[model samples]
Target: MEKLDVLVLLDVSGLEDKEKFEKHLKKEGFHTVPDEAFVYTAESSTTTFSTKAYILEVFKKGLQKNTFLDANLIFLLNETPYPAYYYDKNSNDFELSESKEAI
Candidate 1:
């Protein structure tokens, strides 16, 4: 499987434990995008799942335990930008956003 390039936008503005969250992100193997706040990138190998499915799994897995947070996940499988996801406080999980620029 080809490596998928993923862009992650984590909104930790509401969280108090920013250091812990950053540590968690580092442990998850995500690299911070240079000169960008809360922006990250990761290369993923998706052999068994589609790009969307893979990103959803990643987004869910990256959530902070016992805290509701929001994130935007964008992945490119074949050039065009796929739908992004946002953390829905009501659902307490990631949900698809209509636009990649959605906030």
Candidate 2:
């Protein structure tokens, strides 16, 4: 299976049932890491190394640099030449967009 990314809206305080979350996602056959700043998937129709790298970069920034917390809502993309959609929920309404630059 190829690496994929899923952006999760995590609580600033922390996540509840984190282990369970990972377990549930894994059980459903989607690669998961609940404690990660962002959740990613490998269950996409196709996989690419670039996409994998993009996911890692975003997660690293979110976890290490706290970029994910910068906005109530932010959009992220799966690492790939053609990015996937990550909805940001900070605004009055959910926001959506794609990544154009390299991760």
Candidate 3:
């Protein structure tokens, strides 16, 4: 379904990890936008799942780009190519997680 605006893409439904991420972002004084976005993603043509894509931008950058980044955190999952956690301050770069376990 069409993403509920670009800001709502960060909504992680009811996942506890998502909640913790949200709280952590807020604790860091970062402003997060809710982006409950879903894309009909397909892998190998036959495998597909309506997965969620989330992004966060610092308040300053969000104002310039009209998008926000998840300040000090990113929504993580095990299926992706990199570790499930990371810290990305630069809006245009992807920084992978350093620890194997969530700290």
**Highest-scoring model, TM-score:** 1
Q: Return the lDDT, model 2, position 79.
A: 34
TM-score of 1: 0.66
Instruction: Return model 3's CA RMSD, one decimal.
Output: 11.8
Worst 10 residues of 1 by lDDT: 64-73
Give per-residue CA lDDT, model 1, range 31-97, as digits (tens): 7788987776777676525545655655565564535444555554445566667777777667778
In model 2, the clashing pairs are 4-41, 5-40, 6-40, 51-79, 72-90, 73-90
Cα error, candidate 3, residue 94 (Å): 1.1
Instruction: State each model's C-alpha RMSD to the native.
Output: 3.1, 9.4, 11.8
Which candidate number has the best lDDT? 1
Question: Which tens-of-lDDT digit does each residue in 1-103 have in candidate 3?
Answer: 2322211222222332444444444553434543432211221211113122223233223323333434223332223432333435464544445765432
* lDDT of all predictions: 0.62, 0.40, 0.33
Off by over 4 Å in 2: 1-13, 33-39, 46-78, 81-103
lDDT of 3 at 62: 33
The local distance difference test score of model 2 is: 0.40
- What is the C-alpha local distance difference test score of candidate 3? 0.33
Q: How many pairs collide in each candidate, listed in order?
A: 0, 6, 13
Deviation of model 2 at 75, angstroms:
8.2
RMSD of 2: 9.4
